[model samples]
Target: MHIYSSHVLVCSGTSCTSKKSPELIKKLEEGIKRKKLDEKIQVITTSCFGLCAEGPIVVVYPEGAIYSNVTLNDIDEIINEHLVKGRIVKRLLSGNNEGNNSYESADFFKKQVRIALRNCGVINPEIIEEYIAYDGYQALGKVLTTMTPEQVIDKVLDSGLRGRGGAGFPTGRKWLFAANAKGDKKYVCCNADEGDPGAFMDRSILEGDPHSIIEAMAIAAYGIGSDQGYIYVRAEYPIAVKRLNIAIDQAKELGLLGDKIFGTDFSFNLELRLGAGAFVCGEETALMTSIEGKRGEPRPRPPFPANKGLFQKPTILNNVETLSNIPIIILKGADWFKTIGTKKSPGTKVFAIGGKINNTGLVEIPMGTTLREVIYDIGGGIPNGKKFKAAQTGGPSGGCIPTEHLDVPIEYDTLIELGSMMGSGGLIIMDEDNCMVDIAKFFLEFSVDESCGKCPPCRIGTKRMYGILKRITEGKGEEGDIETLEELAETIQAAALCGLGKTSPNPVLSTLRYFRHEYEEHIVNKKCSAGVCKELLDYIIIPNDCMGCTKCIKVCPTKAITGKIKEPHIIDQEECIKCGACLEACPFGAIIRK
Candidate 1:
């Protein structure tokens, strides 16, 4: 093992990499080499530190200094001043004040209890040695050498860990079924094909701690008596895929993944299968079908994956986050793991928070944390003092959480009771500027576009619902439009072919359930209270605020405003395009929308 005087960890996750963290890392490495301090100081390019809004993040150990928004220019200063002179770069440090500058003390990271994201920003993901140094494969080693197959399953079952991939099925029960099933071969499949928008929890884990997933999968294979496994990942996640392949190769070379792991008779082998970015494939059967070289579409249940899956073999499938927990549970015992979360739904959940939020990044908190805490304390609330209207969770398939339900605890059962499900943890915050009708339309359109078209309810029913939402948003809604949408949403939910279809109407249903007043306003009053439907709005010049500046008149696309140089302006409502250009260009604060 190599030790250094200082270890500078730079975030290299997708968010940070997109923001030129790579360049900063290269600069830091070159600077360290140039200064002849390679032996004393080491630079490690790791994964996301979770505070994406402040990326690219740099955390220097010894003092545990965290710096955000780092640049190549800042790298030289960091190396010279912080490394050589033993001085901290106060200017580049994160947090509102110097007291909470590091990630450990920062509010964003303090609220988070990272289990799946444990090694993300802490280790060099590209290197297997760093992962092993952190007790990475110890669980696998313990399971192979000490525990029996049924004992491993019993331990997992007692841990009370559930699937983190939307559905909260008991992990132990699923493993037991797969193990008990009579088949020549049983396979373990990892659902790394995370398709939800704003959801990158799995991707970050793969990029940062691929070894965790590998170790967990190996443990699962031992428990289920499966000698082969497959990880189904999306092609869009280039960083995750690259790191996973590296981890696999490294583990095989280290005699961890290949035949006779730890010199036992268990010869478990794992392979990678890339997905085509299909939203439907997030479902287990659909994912298995895609891995079998078929089009990704849902198959009817009852002969579930446990009985017949992936080339007609018995299979146990779990997502990246779910698998990541297995190693810890095995290492730390089920009682300790169960003590962290709720009685029914134990363990932590990782969410990818985005949309109108101050803290836009990945966060993993205990299962029972309320929405208020996650949105306000952890997310830093909405940006620019915007009023938070609602938050959309579970991607297009999940419902929106209104202000009335802010204190609701975020468990699978509670979320489902609130007309939402914890679907892969995509929590998108919406402010007052966002229209509920428009929000429904946006998600409905996404569902319509991404629909596999395997069934009529989701294929045509969702289209009809989207059409009604589109009409309402365009100010063409009729008296019966709301009733029609509600009816269609119910029908789709009850009659759709798969979970994707059944849940596709969630956005519309949830919006109507909570913000039906908005729908009524659009349908009856022929007005968009949020001023979102352009056709329903009319521009007017406020007589009191107008100063005859003629700014609105000059910039109006249709010349809607007319006035002399020193008098109040008059807007020609007939010619107004409702582009809000007059409102934007008015220096007198006169132009208003009615």
Candidate 2:
């Protein structure tokens, strides 16, 4: 094996790529080559480091020095100061200098358990040998060599590995059902169609460790007696698609896929079918429908995918994350895998944590990890020292967890009990500055626009709820608007055709459940406490904090502010459009939202 004194792992995930990580990689390669240290120093491009806020992350191995927010200029300094000279560059360091600035000591990784993301930042995904070096296909090899199909299913079942795709179904049970079904031909399908807002768990997994997915799917095929599989991924994920294609080609070349895998009689083949970015296609039926060259829409269940699925055959469908865990479960016994998370929900969950948070990125915390730890400890608390008002989990289909339940153990059942489902792992943080009514409206608008119109509850009911929220935010809410929203939500929840329609009203319902007072403030009092709803806001000049240098008057979008040069400003409520231009213009803390 080739040995190097130092190994450089760089972030090539989507977010970092957008920030010109590729360009940064080019600079590093050029610098290392110029210095003739390429043999001594190895540079590899890997997946996300979870701390995406610090894009273009560079981690120096043997030293474990993590450099965040790395730019083209910072790279030369990193090479000269850290790589060649053996001196740590303090400026580009990720964490604080208070002893916890190092990668191992950073608060970001304190609460994270990266099982699905095990090889993400450690190895190059494009190179199949790097994956093999990390024991990537060892699980599949073990399965094909020693374990029987029944033993594989039993092991997964005993592992308590529940489906990571929104609904928390048992993974082994789903496999068993598909395996038991009598079909001339069965198919294993992967749902990489992660349509949830602020969710990128699956995308990161595919990009970081595509081989794991391939290995896991092969294991699943062996377990469920399937020979052909297809990954229904969204077309928007160009990078994931490219990596998956490369991985498949590599696996085929090594005889890991295609036919007689590992010299066994079990022969399997896989293909990729791209979707048109339909939110509804995230549903298993819709995903299958899209894969079959039809318009993406959810079909009636009872004949679930496991029984009669894609192309009228027994099909087992699992999300990207759920599949990523399969190989590990096979390698490590079920009992071993069950020891990590809670009894019901075993294993780590990858969450795409974004919005109003200090450290915004991906995190894979254990199942029973508390929201407080995930938000305060892992998320690094809210930005601008804003008080954490609520956290929206499960995206549009899930509910909002208010501050009262912040300490609740983050398990599958607990989140649902608190009125939110543990969706495909999107935990959006909301600060005190957010208006709950507007927040509800934002998600409702997404639900309304993305609705397939297959059923009235999602197609029509979501539209009605969106309209009501729009009216409420605009200071035009009626007396019984809240009651109407609740009624519509309940109806949608009951009468909807699929999981998408049934859970479509979750955002509105949950916001109404937790932040009812905010709705009351908007409708009954004609005010927005969080200053989010523009129509419900009243800007007032705090005379005590005002220095009054004609700044407010000059900067007012409308001629609302008028006062003498040395005197405190006066805001005309009638003239003020509540654009808060005067607020932005004021150097002093004078402007207040009333």
Candidate 3:
């Protein structure tokens, strides 16, 4: 085996790739070669470190010094000082410390418990050997050789691991249902079609540790007595798709997949099916429908996917995050898995944290971790000293969590009780400046656009709700608009055909429940206190504060402000467009948004 004195791990995930980590890799390799240290040093590409905001990241091993925001110019110093001289570059190091910074030492990583993201930022994903060295396929081998099919299912049931794909369904129960359902041919499937806004948990797993998913699927197939499987992922995730295809080819070459694994009687084959970027395909039945080469639309449930799915065969569908945990559970025993998280909700959850927070990245914490910790401890609180107002979880199909509920534990049942849900783990923080009514309108608009038009509740009901929200934000809201929205939300939640339709009104309903005053203010008082609704705002020149600065007048597109150079300006309200251009142009805090 080849041994290196030192290794440099560069982040190659989509976030880091976009920030030129690939180019940084090329430069590092060239620099290492130029310095005649190529033999002693190894340069490898890994996936996200979860601290996406700190990319492009480079971690030097043996010492494990993380270098954040790396550029092409920083390569020479890293190769020379760290690789050759054995001196850590303090200037390029991640974290606020002047001394040492490693994986466990970093603040952002302190609260996180990486299970699904364990291999990410650690192993070179494209290389199958790297994954193998870390005991990648050991779980599959164990399941195939040691454990019986029923035992495997029973172990999962004992683990208390719920599905990480937002619905929080029992993973073992789903597998058992598929196993018990009498079918001549049963199929195992992985749902990598993550369509939530600002959510990339599935994509990261696919990119960083594709082999894990393959191993788990094989284990599941063995348990369920299935010989064929399919993975439905969006084509938009080109990196993930490429890595997954590579992993599959590698597994087949090693006899881990395809005919008779480990020379046993079991035989399983896998295939990939790409979606056309349909958000509704995230639903189980819709995903199966899409996989069958049909339009991605939800089918009403009498027979769930376990009984009749994937071309009318008994099938079990698990999302990428859920499947990633299976191999670990098999290898590390159910008891060990159950010890990590809350009793009801065992194991950790990966959250894609974004918007208004200081640290915008991906975080995986235990299920019962409070919103306060996620926002303050891990996320570094809201940016620019702004007070945190609300947090929106579960994307468009979920609800908003106001400041009052910041202390609430972020479990599935707890979130549901608070009128929100654990929808695919997209946590968007909002500051004091955010208008809750506007935020609700934003999510409703997304639902309106993504709706498949399959049922009236989602098709027409969500559209009507969106129109009402739009009117409220634009200063055209009627007095009874809030009541109408509430009525519509109730109807949609009750009568919608599928999960997507039923949950489409969640954002609107939750916002109204917690921030009803914001809506009433927008409608009754014709004002936006947060200064977000431009149509409801009237920018006024504070006469005493205005020092006759013509900056506002010069920058105004509408030419609404007019004044002599030495005198306070007068804004022509009739001509003003509420574009906030004058507000921004004002230097002395003279223009106030009301």
For TM-score, the strongest prediction is 3
Candidate 3, 371-455: lDDT as tens digits: 9999999999888999998899999889999988988888889999999999888999899899998888888888899999998
Q: Model 2: residues >4 Å from true position, as ranges?
A: 1-102, 543-548
Could you tell me every candidate's TM-score relative to the true structure? 0.83, 0.83, 0.84
User: How many backbone clashes can be found in candidate 1?
Assistant: 0
What residue pairs are clashing in model 1?
none
Ranking by TM-score: 3, 1, 2
Q: By descending lDDT, how would the candidates be arranged?
A: 3, 2, 1
231: Cα error in model 3, Å:
0.8
lDDT of candidate 2 over 406-425, digit per residue (tens) = 88999899999999999999
State in Å the error of residue 31, model 2. 30
lDDT for model 2 = 0.91
Off by over 4 Å in 1: 1-100
